[model samples]
Target: MNAEPADQIRLLEVQALDSRIAQLDHKRSTLPEHAELERLGADHAQLRDLLVAAQTEESDTAREQTKAEQDVDQVRQRAVRDQQRLDSGALGAKDLENVQRELASLARRQSDLEDVVLDVMERREAAQQRAAELAERVAAVQSETAAAEARKAEALEAIDAEGFRVAKEREVLAAAVPDELIKLYDKLRGQGGGVGAARLYQKRCEGCRLELNITELNEVRAAPANQVVRCENCRRILVRTADSGL
Candidate 1:
């Protein structure tokens, strides 16, 4: 392929812009906020699960406490009725003795029910505390996650802006080159490592980081100034300048 010397030089500018665009893309993906958000997301999920379990326990304990209180109330009501009958003297002697014995049994039953109610109350209080603590932890994690997401978004926006600017510059520079030359460059860039053109500095192929052998340097030195030359090692367009040391 043949391209004007100036046009071939412009290809290097396009390559530089392309390299910058690639760097910006890499920076966007590897932003620190991305990792932070991932960690925060995991914590939030676990905390939410714990919060749910605590809430369920709290609900269960609440129902248990209510049932226990109801049992205590029923026992107390029955004892009150028995005591009223004994005080009214409405039963014969034998019947009165039977009523007194029933009252004693009801008292014991009420005491045991009251103890159960107290135990249930204590358990419910513990569950409520645990649920509240877990809720606070979940909220803290959510706040952290939100902050990380905001940071990630800001970083991406900046990277995207720079990439867009570099791409526009590349488009303008590439447009000035001959279409056929651009086609060859694009093909080589796809096959190579994002570099289709490189400067031959001091008789070295910058693309492959290898100095050209004596034979390769002689050929390049003999080539016409307008003729496009490729590096023997990397097959990239070798853009010659005064520093080529031919």
Candidate 2:
């Protein structure tokens, strides 16, 4: 493919722009904010699960406390009724003794139930504290995730803007070259590790960073200025300059 020397030089500019675009894409993918956001998201999920568990525990414990208090109140009420009957002087000695014994039993029951209520209340308090702590953790993680998302968005926007600019420059550069030459360059670029053209400087193929043998250098020297030459080693379009040492 014979392209004007000027058009061939434009291929190098297009290659530069393409390379920058590729770099920007890579930067967009590997941004640190992405990794941070992923980590924060996982942490947020785990904290939410823990918060749910703590809330369930607190609720269950609170119910247990309520039931214990109700039990105590029921036993106290029975004791109160028995004492009132004994005080009414309507009972015989045997009946009064039975009433007093029943009241004593009720008092013990009430005491035991009160103890249970206290224990359950303590447990409920602890569970409530745990729930609060978990909720705080979830909130913190949510904040971090939001910040990370914002940072990721900002970075992506910048990268995309720059990539768009570089692509536009590539388009303009590509348009200046003949269609046939552009096709050839595109095909080579697709297969040449993203480099379709490279400069031949000091008898070296810049694409492969390999110096040409004497015979290869001589053939390139004999080629006309407008004749397109390819690197024997890497098969990339080799653009010659004054310093090519050919």
Candidate 3:
């Protein structure tokens, strides 16, 4: 980051470029698609569970319907048998009345059970429809997840390549800088929030993007070339430049 005595400011340009590249990488890694894929996965899992639950309910309802149908058949058979017995005069009048009453009760009970079966069937049908809709939705989300993952992977790969290139550049530049000055900058950078130097653009401190104070700017201008000047606003090492990007 520096030379014998006055080259500390020379590294400010590379530092600014590095900061910009790092900012771009941060933005790339935080794309919406990354989080979106996770949400899609969670939704798909829930839909699959919902589908399984719907199928289970359908099975249970079918069993209940079969049992209800068999119960109705049994009641009908018993009523027919009792009617035949009454016709054969195997029972007295009072007994016939009791059997008829019992038959009427079974008919009402069978009617109630059939109604319940119908309700359960309707519920199962609705659940089946819901499950089908969920299945389609899950498939659609899976497609979206694939596309998002591709985009995210491409972005990460590009950033990784760019980072490698920049890291190589940093290594080259760091070697050219004096060991003592580089060590000094590294120490200051650790204490200065990982930014050891920043450029002066117009009358502002580029490190904090703030306007420099009149006193501070005058002091920096009067400072010797070999001397270090720090920004009062951001506490970052300030490097005066002939040209600074806005």
Candidate 4:
């Protein structure tokens, strides 16, 4: 906290820069752009869930449909051979009985195949519904992504200009400070939220807003004019002016 009047001025500039940066950061985080980002995130999650459900339904339907088609084809082929055998009239009694048994087996296979096909159709219908919902969600998220990007661009363009201007002034002020003092100020300022410098206002440490005791004030007063004095209360470097000398 032992810093010159010049260095304290620099510290004030740094503090100002820090304040501006803090405001810009807050504005950036709380921008309308961030709201859409949140909405986009939610939409992204919901779409992912819907996509999973659709994929599951589609996969199940495909499996069931394939099995049903294969079953139906096998059964129809057997049914055709059975009918040919019955039409040929070259079958003995045992052959006719075997043909009838084969026909009965084919009929039962066809019934099972029909049931599987019905279930697959239902699954496909549900999958289509979910797919449509997912598509809409994806589209909405995509739009939100676009809008948020635009909003970010606008916010950055608007706020960064002023921040850069103040930052340049801060740099100018910092150049006036000695390197070792700048380092010390940076170290302490970080701990005090950019308040490394305090004015001796009404015999008080403005940084901590606490009045200095008589002994400390006397000690500070005895210091040389160019010498740096630190506040005992908040450990902030103090700058005394003639109008409000401590």
The candidate that achieves the highest TM-score relative to the unseen native structure: 2
**Backbone clashes under 3 angstroms, per model:** 0, 0, 0, 0
lDDT of 3 by residue, 117-141 (tens): 7887787788778778877887898
Which stretches of candidate 4 lie above 4 Å from their native place? 1-14, 22-46, 49-53, 174-193, 218-227, 241-246
lDDT of 2 by residue, 1-246 (tens): 687899888888888887888789789899999889889988988889889999999999988888888888889888889989999999999999999999888988888898898899899999999999999889888888888898989989999888888888888888888999889988999999889999998999999999999999999989999999999999999999888987
User: Please, what is the whole-model Cα lDDT of each candidate in the order they appear?
Assistant: 0.91, 0.90, 0.76, 0.79
What digit string (tens of lDDT, one per residue) describes model 1 on residues 67-143? 99888888888888888899997899999999989998988898898889889888889989999999999999888
Worst 10 residues of 1 by lDDT: 21-30
Candidate 4, backbone clash total: 0
Runs in model 3 lying further than 4 Å from the true structure: 1-9, 45-53, 83-101, 210-219, 243-246
Higher-TM-score candidate among 2 and 4?
A: 2
RMSD for each of the candidates = 1.9, 1.7, 3.7, 4.2
TM-score on alpha carbons, each prediction? 0.91, 0.93, 0.77, 0.72
lDDT of 3 at 204: 85
**Poorly placed runs, candidate 2 (over 4 Å):** none
TM-score of 2: 0.93
